[model samples]
Target: MSSPSSTPAAPAVDRLRSWLQGRDLAVFHSVANRHWPGADPLLPQLSRSANHGLLWVGAAAGIAAFGSSARSRRAALRGVASLAVASAAINTVGKSAVRRRRPRVDLVPVVRRLKRQPVTTSFPSGHAASAAAFATGVALESGGWGAVVAPVAAAVAASRVYTGVHYPSDVLAGAALGIGAAFALRGIVPTRGQLPAPGRPPGEAPALPGGEGLVVVVNRASGTAPATASLVREALPLADVVEVAPGGLATALTDAAGRGRALGVCGGDGTVNLAASAAATHGVPLAVFPGGTFNHFAYDLGIETVQETAAALTAGDAIRVDLGRFRPGPNGEDGADGYFLNAFSLGVYPDLVRTREHWSSRIGGWPAGVLAAFHVLRGQRPLEAELQGRRRPLWLLFVGNGLFQRVGPAPGRRHNLADGLLDVRVVHGGRTPALRLLAAAVAGPLTRSPAHAAVRRRRVRIAGLAPGTPYAYDGEVAHSGEELTIDKLPEALTVYCPMPL
Candidate 1:
C-alpha cells in the first residue's frame, strides 16, 4: 500500500528510532550502576517527597512567608503557576502520547530504588518537569531565589535516573518542556521587572548613612507594624523610631517630622498619607516602610521592605510624586480639606469600607470585607450626586492621584507616579449594583459604557451631595459635606524610592 518514496523513508525512520532506544538503555544502565555515598538513601527520599508536587508547594509557601519583598511573593506565585502548567501538560499529553515502559531496575542498586515504584510512563518524568518548571519560574522573577532552587531541581532530576524509574532522555525531555512552560507563562503575564517602574522625576534627598538624622513613626495598630518597625530600627540603628497607638498617630507624625532631617513612616496607606502631609508641611523627604495590610503607595514606589528604604536612604534615592487633595472652593467651607496619596472614592465603596471596619474586629479582614460587600450591594441605594455640573445617580466615584493602567488580569498599577493626572472612574447608578461593579472591574482601566465611565483630569468638582455622605481615601473612611473640589498638587511631595534599572 506504500509508495516508492514512503517505502525508502520508513526504513530510515525505523533505524533511527532503534538507535535512540539503544542509546537510552545504555545510559540508563550506566546511571544504575553508578554509586554516590550519601545519595543512596537521600535520592530515593527526595524523589518520593516530590510526588504529586507536594514538595514544590511547600517550597513556594516558605518563599512567600519568609521573603520580605513583593518580588519574593510574586516569584513564589509565578513558580506555582508554572509548575501547575507543566504538571498538567505532562500528565494529560506527554504520558498518553508515548506509552514507553518503565526502565528495568535490575542493574540499579537495591538501596537506591524506591520502595513504591511509579506506574506512569517513562518517556517523560513528571517530578523532573515540576521541579524544573518551579525553579525556572522562580528564577525568572528573582535570580537569587532561582540560584537557591536550581540545585535542588537538578538533584531531583538526577534522582529519577538513579532510581531507575526514568531514563536520562526522558528526564531531559521533561526538563525542556518544563522550562518552555515557564517562558510561555511569562509571555502571557510579564513580571514586574518587565514592566516600567513607577517612580519617576528623581528628586534630591539627604544621604543618611547608617540612618543618621532619620526618624520613623510606626502605627502600632497597623498589621505587622510593630514587628516590621523593629526590623527597621535594627536595620537603621541611628534612626529614631516612634511606635504610636491608633489615637496618637497625628502627634507622633508631627513630632517626628518636625525634628528629623528625613521623615519615615512605617504603616498602611492611611498612615503614609499622614506622614506625607507632615513631611510636605515641614519640607522633608519621606521614607515609607510597608507594614500595613495593603501598602498600596509603598508598593507602587517599588519599596516594599525596610531594607530597601534603608538602602535608598543611604544612597539618597528619591522621587517626586503628586498628591491628591479634596477641599472646599473659595466660596464653600463645609467640606473638609485633606490629601490622599493613593485614591479617594464615594458612594458604595465608602459605605463598604465603613461597614467592613465595623465588623472587622469580630470576624477577620477578608471575611468582613466579603460580608460588607454583600450587605452594601443588597441594601444600599444609588448615591445622588452632581458630577462636574450635571446631577445624576451614581453607584461609585473613584479618583486616583496618578494615572492607573491595567497589567494582565490583575488590578491597575501606576507606572509613572508623577504623571500629574487624576484617574477618575464613575459607575452610573443602575438596577443591579453588583453587576455594574463586576462589569467595571472586567472592563479594566479604559472603561466607557452607559453603566461606567473613566477619564483623566487635572481637577474635578462634585456637588449636590447629601449631607453626611461617607467618603473614603486611602482606606480611611469619613463623612463628607454637600460639595468637594478634588485637585492635584503636581510633584508636590518628595519620597524615598529606588530608581528603575
Candidate 2:
C-alpha cells in the first residue's frame, strides 16, 4: 500500500468541514451532559415536533386565520412559504451534500435521546432551519406575531443540540441557511415596497383648516355594525355628517363635494368607488373610514376603523392615490366605461364575484369566496383575450390600481397608492383551470405551474371578446361587449389616508 503521505489531497472545503465538525463535537458532548432532568420530556418532544415541519405548518395556519384583513392572511402565507424553502433546502441539499454525521448516543443519556431518532445525515439541523425560517418570515409580515414566536423558535433550534441530534455548529448553519431562504423568497414573493407607511407624500393635499370644514358621509346600510352614523359622529364631533341612501351615494357625494371644503365617505368599496369620482372631479380631499365586510381600499391605506380615520382627519394627514379607469370597448367608445378604486377582472373571476354576492350575507366574505369558487369553477370557460394586442385564451384576467399581493384565487392588498402601475395577474387556460387554481391556493403563487403570469404596466386594452362579457369591478359586476380598455389616472384622487402610501 502507498504511504499515507502519498494520498490524494482532500478539497479545502472538506478540510474546513472536518475541522469545524471536530470543534463542534466537543461542544455537543458538553451539551449532552449538561441538560436538566426536565429536558428529557421537553427536548425530545420539540425534536419530534419539528421532524416533518408539522409545528411550523400549524403556526402558519394559525396566523392566517387570526385576522380578517388580507394583510393578516398574506403574512401567515408568506411565513409558510419560507418554511417550505427551508425544508426543501435542508433535506435535498444541506444534509445529503454535506454528509455530516449525527452525534453519538454514547454522549447522550438513554432517557434524553429522541424516541424516533432521525436516520438522515446531520450536517445542518432541519428543525433549526424550519424554526428560523418560520420566525423570520412571520416577523417580516406581522411584527406583533413575530415578536410572540421568536423566543419559541430560538428554544426549538437550541433543543436539537440538547437532544444530541445536531451539533451547535449544525444548528447555527441551519439557522443561517433558513434566514437566507426567507430573504430570497421576499424578493420572489409580492412583498417588497408593499404596505403603506406613516407619513406624507408629495402633491397638493389640502390642509384641513379644522374638523369643522370636513364633511363625512355615513352609509348606515353598509357593513356589519348597526350604528355606523353614530360611530362617525362620535368620532368626528366637529365635522358635518351626511346620510345618503345606499343607491344615491354618487349624487349625494357630488352634492356634498360642492358644498364642503373636504369630503369623507364611510362605507364599503362600492360606495367608495362612487365617492372617489366626485372627490376627484371637485378637487377635494376625501377621507376614508373602514366600515365594510372587506375594506380593501381603507385597509391598504392603513385605516382599520372609524376612530383611526377620524384621528387622522383631525390631524390633517392625507395622500394622493391612483384610480383604475376602465372602458367596455375599444378606446372607451362605450359611455358605460368607469373608474375603480381597488380591482377589476373578467373570465371565471367575474363569475366568482357574482356568486359571492349571492352568498356573502349568509356565509361571510372569505367563506362566500370559497363557496363561489367551487360553484363557478365547475362551469368556467376560457376567454379569448387580446392582451397588449396579442390574442390568447385565458382563464382569468385581473387588473388593480396599484400592486396587490397575490394570496389566493384573487390578488388582494396594495403596497403603494401611487406607484402608477396597474398590477395584472393572469391565469393561463388549462385543461382544468379550477384544479390548477385550487393548487395555487394551497401551494402559493410561487408553486411551479405552467399556468400563471404577472405583469405591471401603465395601460392595457383587451379586444376580441364576445359581446355581453361578464365583468366585475371592485366587488360590483357589469357586462362588456367584445372589447375593453384599462388605464390609470395618475394621482387622480386626493384621499385622507391615515398614512402615506
Candidate 3:
C-alpha cells in the first residue's frame, strides 16, 4: 500500500486530494498532533471498543429511560442497536481478514510520542467504521440531527489520519463499510412515520383551491432578505408559508396550489426563475419579493422595494408577464441560447461567479459588491461573437425583455417587456473597447452610441462564439451549450403586483 504522501492514481481521487489540500485539514492535523502526542497508541484500543459503541450505547440508554414518548425511545434504541451490531461485525471480521499496517509512526508527532504500543493491523480504521455506522443510523432516524452526527464521524476518521495511526484509505474503506451496514439495517427497521408525497414535478404548478392562501418560495441564502415565513404572516395573515429547497421549487408551487390563490416568492433571480417556470406552466398569478443579492428580476420588473412588493401582495392584483425560452443548439455545435425574461450576457460575469466565495462569508452587502466589481475589472477579457441573424460581429450581447435604466445614449433604448419583441444590444470591440464597455456598464443600462445599438427582433440566434464563453441567464450560468435561440413566450406567466402599472 502506498503512503498518504504518494500521489493518487484515479483522476477523481486526485481532484479530491487537491480539494482537501486547499481546505484547513492540513492545519487541523498539525494542531491534533501537537495536542494529543500519545493518541496513536490509544487508537488500536479505541477501534476495538466496537466503533461508535460508546456514543450509541450511551444515547440509546438515555433515550430509553427518559425519552418523551415510546416512539422516540424505540427510534433511538433501534438506531443504536443497528449501528452497534454492524460496527462489531465489520471491525472484528473485516479488519481481521484484510490486515494492513499504519504509515510510518515516526513521520507525525502524535505517532512518535505514543506511550503504549498498538497491536491490531490498521487497514480499515475501527474509529471511522464506528463513526460511520452510528452517524448513518442517526441520519436514518432524524434528518436535521443526523446532519450534526455525520460530521463528528468524519472528524473522528480524519483524526485517525492526523495522528498517523491509520492510513487515509483505511478510514475510507471503514466509512464505506459502516454506511453500507447502516443502509442494509434501515431496510428492515422502518422510519417512525411516513411523509406526504411530493406535490408537483418540475415545470408544473400546483392547483390552488379557492385562491386565498399565500405560498412563499424563498432562497435562504439571499442577502438579508426578510424571512419568507415572517413576510407571509405579516402581509397575509391567513396564508401558508412553504420553504423551497434547491430543485424543490416545482414541488413547493404544486403543494401551494391547493392551499392559496396567491403565491409570493422571496429569493434571488434563480428562485424567481424557478417560481416563474412553475407559475407559467400552471397559469397561476405569482408575486415577486426580491430577496437575492442583486434583485435583478425585481429590478427588471420595476419592483424596487421589498416593502412596496409586500404591500402590493397585501392589496392583491394580478398581471400577465412575458417569458423567454432559451433553445440550446443541437449536436453541441454552437454556443448556448435560451430565453431569459431578464437579461442574458456572455463574458466576465460567469468567471466572476466561478471564483467568488466571499459572498457567504462577508456580513454586509457592500463588501460583496465591491469584490464582484474588482473581479470583473481585473479578469475582464474580450471574446468574438457572431449574432447569426444580425449585421455585426459582436463582443458583448445583452438580450432583454424590458428597457434597462439608461446607462447612456446607446442605440437600443426602447426595449419594453410587454411589447412582444425581444431587445438586442451589441457592443463592438474595436469601436467601443474594454474601457468603454466598463464605462457603459457603470453609466446605466441604456447606451445610445454608434458603438452600441439596440435592435428589436421577434427571434434571434447567436453562433460562432469561442468555446467557454460564459453565458448567464437570469444570473446563473447555463451548464453547457453554444448555439442559442431566443424567442418570446408572450403573456405566458401570470404575476401578482400592485395595481396601476
Candidate 4:
C-alpha cells in the first residue's frame, strides 16, 4: 500500500506542467519582443478562468440564496435567469455568426498547458458571456454591487486565457452578451412585479393641475453680473427665486425640494451642476435657466439661450437625465457626501476655480476663463490623479454624465443622456510653455481634440493630491481638501424633453 498508481498520477501532472510551461514561454517571448513592454500577458489566462460555467452558476446561486426579502430574492433570480438566456442567445446568434478565433492561438500563449486543440469558431467567449450576464444581473439588483460584479466577471473571462480556452475579445463578447441578455430579460419582467388587469394607461398630462410652485437657485456671482433678478422673475412667475449666497446651493436646493415639482437653476455650469445634483437626489427634474458665463451644460443639451430654457419651462416639456454621486474616500466618515448632475473636475479646472475666485467680479466669464488659462499655464502644475484604480499624473480631469462640449469646428454636439456611461477627459501636460497652453485653448474644447483624448469609465477615483485643492461639481466649488469619488447613477432621474431634437 505504498501508493495506488503513483506513477500514473506523475505522468498526468508532468503533462499538465509541460503544457503550462509552453504557454508561459510563448507569452514571455511575445511580450518581450513587443514594442510596448507593459502589455498584460496574463489577460487571456484570466479570461479563460472567468468562463467556467461553474463560476457563473455559483455566483447566481449565491446571490439568489442570500437575498434578504422575497422581492430581493425574485429580483436576484430574475437577473441570473436573464443573464443565462442572454448569454446563450448572444453566443448562438451573434458570436456564432462572427466565428472569430481566440487570440492565444492566433497570437501568443503565456501558459502552454492551458492551451488545447484550437476550436474552429470563437467569435465570443462563452465564459465571458456567462460571467458578464451573471455580473450584470447581480449589478442591476445590487446597485453599487453591480460595479463589483462586472470586474469579477471580467477576471473570470480573463482566466479562459490562462486555462488556454478563449481569446481576450472572446471573453469580452461573452460578457457583453450575458449582460445584454440580463438587461433584456429584466426589461421583460418588471422589477416591481407584474401589472394588474388592463386599465387605461395614465394620461400624458399631469394628473394634478400644473402647480405654480417653482424654485430657482440663482448664483449671484455667475456671468455678466447676475442678470437682474427682475429678468428671472419675468421669465418664471409663480416661482420662488432665492438668491443663493456664495456656498449655499446645497441648502437652497434641499429647501426648494420641500416646495415644488421642479427646481430651476440659474447660473454657470457650476451652478447648474450643483442644482442638478440636489434635484436628482430629491428625485426632481431640473429646469435650466442658463445665466452662467459658460453655460456648457445648457449649450450641450441644446438649450441655446436663456429664452429657450424659459420657453421650454412654459411648454412644460422636461426630460429626465442621469445623475452622479460623489462620496468621500474610504478613510473619510459617512454622510460627508455630495452629488453632481453634469460633470466633476479635478487638477487643472480646480486650480482655475481658485484663480478665477481671486479675480474681480467685474470681469466677464470668457475673459476670466482666459485669464485663468494663462495663470494656470504660467503657474499651475499638473497633479497626479488616479481613475478607476489606475494612477497617472494629469493636467486636468473631467467626468461628465450627460452632455459635454465637442471641440473643433463643431463645438456643441451633445452626448445622449441614456447611454449609461460617463465621459472622462484626461488632459495630459508636462511643463509646457505658456504659448503652448494658449495654443491648446485656442484649439477649442480640449476634450474633443486628439491632444486631449477623453477616457470613459463607469466609476472614477481621484487621489494622490491634497484634498483642499478646490474641485467643482457643475460650477460650484466644494470646500477645498474634500476627496472626490464620482460614480454613475444610471437612469436615476427622469425628465420630459422635446422629442425630435
Name the candidate that leads on lDDT: 1
- The whole-model lDDT of each prediction reads 0.88, 0.78, 0.60, 0.60
Error of 2 at 80 (Å): 1.2
Positional deviation of residue 457's Cα in model 3 after best superposition, in angstroms: 2.5
TM-scores for all candidates? 0.87, 0.71, 0.50, 0.51
Report the lDDT tens digits of candidate 1 across residue range 295-316: 8899888877788899999999
- Candidate 4: where are CA atoms >4 Å away? 1-211, 224-228, 330-335, 403-412, 433-453, 479-484, 495-501
Best by TM-score: 1
lDDT of 2 by residue, 1-501 (tens): 877765566566678878886888788877877857687888778778876778878877777665544556666777788989998988788987888677786688887777777888887888888899988888887787888778878989988888778889889999999898887888676452353362235445555534678887766677643366677777677788887768777778988888988888877888788888889889988888766677788877777767777766766667888889998667888776589998888888788988987898786777898999899888667888788799988888878788765533445556678888887777778889877665544543323457766678788889988888888888888888778899989888887766542
Clash pairs of candidate 1? none
Runs of candidate 1 with Cα error greater than 4 angstroms are: 1-20, 35-45, 105-120, 328-332, 351-382, 430-435
Task: Arrange candidates, best TM-score first.
Answer: 1, 2, 4, 3
lDDT of 4 by residue, 229-321 (tens): 557677656667889775787788788866777777777777777676676768776767666655666644555445555565666655555
Worst 10 residues of 2 by lDDT: 192-201
Candidate 3 lDDT: 0.60
Candidate 2 accuracy as lDDT: 0.78
Residue 129 lDDT (model 2) = 88
Candidate 3, 29-87: lDDT as tens digits: 56445655555555434444434368566655654444322333445655675677666
